[model samples]
Target: GSFWINAHIEAGKFLWQRSNKTLDSNTRLRTTGQPGDLDSPGDCLSLLVSEDDLEYYPGLPYNPHDCSDNQHYPLCERILQDTQQLLKDPLLVLEETISINIAKMENNVHLILDTIDKSISAH
Candidate 1:
């Protein structure tokens, strides 16, 4: 559970970084009004270096799958899927735990009521 939660947290951080980069790029484009500025040699180099750095990270692996079907970036889509799975795991565990506790509580209640009935009958 902790592992999944940690993975979800890390994925959230990676997604935040990606969105910030996109926002920065968009802001730069809007201010410059020059598409070529976005493809400048320095910008390309920096992008490459940042991507390489991400490769060294444990979480958020880059998926090569085509994201043409979805509006989101491939990595973003994969991260969302992972997040859903991670959330489901914890919920499932909680659900099972609750059911087990409910069963135990029901048994205890039955025993208590039975004991009360016996005491009242003896009186």
Candidate 2:
């Protein structure tokens, strides 16, 4: 889910930069609950999460529950195991269609200052 996300940037020089459209994409990679799925919104997934997750990750409210501990709470042990395994991979929650490194992306943005060298070429 949340796989496809479109982003557009306007390229300009000596004047202004703009876009007729919004900076958003229509990437499709979803997993909606269906019959016999058993992973419906208010089912296994719902029963797995905690109140903190619902508040922090409003998007993936049940994500937290998946990692919730068993033998101590009312949640199922299988759910916790699945959730723990999911977190083991640094690439969890990210749709395969949207493969990206957030740290690298942020670094690229912050490195813009280096481009100043080309701002005014010397004769």
Candidate 3:
């Protein structure tokens, strides 16, 4: 009965997916506020070689088949996907743990209730 955890996680993932799609669109991408300066935001994705020498900025990789049919730079899309999956995993683990604990509670339900009732009566 993880009503709170389950509902909240699903809603968050849904909202993130929708917002990410909107950001990937051309209208937004075109006016994405790219600067004409040398220190463009694009520079952030440049390869970090050996933590010292700043070498090749080879450019975004080929988009994978599963990515948004196009436009998604392979690495960026992967990072997004991985990040989404990583976020989902913890919720799944929490759900599984909740389920397991609930199952265990079933076996001890009577004993647990009795103990609670006894403690309350003594108080």
Total colliding residue pairs, candidate 3 = 0
Query: For residues 4-107, could you state the per-residue lDDT of candidate 3 as single tens digits?
Result: 10100121121123233212211212212232322222121211223222222222211112222232222222234567789999999999999999988886
Q: What's the ranking of the predictions by TM-score, best on top?
A: 1, 3, 2
lDDT of 3 at 99: 99
Better of 1 and 3 by lDDT: 1
* Candidate 1 backbone collisions, by pair: none
Per-residue C-alpha lDDT of model 1 across residues 1-123, encoded as one tens digit per residue: 001111111211212322423223322312233343333321211111245435553343322112222322222223355667898999999999999999999999999999999999999
User: Relative to the true structure, how large is the alpha-carbon lDDT of every model?
Assistant: 0.38, 0.31, 0.34
Between candidates 1 and 2, which one is better according to lDDT? Answer: 1
Model 1: how far is 10 from its true place, Å? 24
Q: Against the hidden reference, what TM-scores do the models get?
A: 0.38, 0.20, 0.31
Name the candidate, 1 or 2, with the larger TM-score value: 1
Candidate No. with top TM-score: 1
TM-score of 2: 0.20
| lDDT, residue 30, candidate 3 | 22
Off by over 4 Å in 1: 1-78
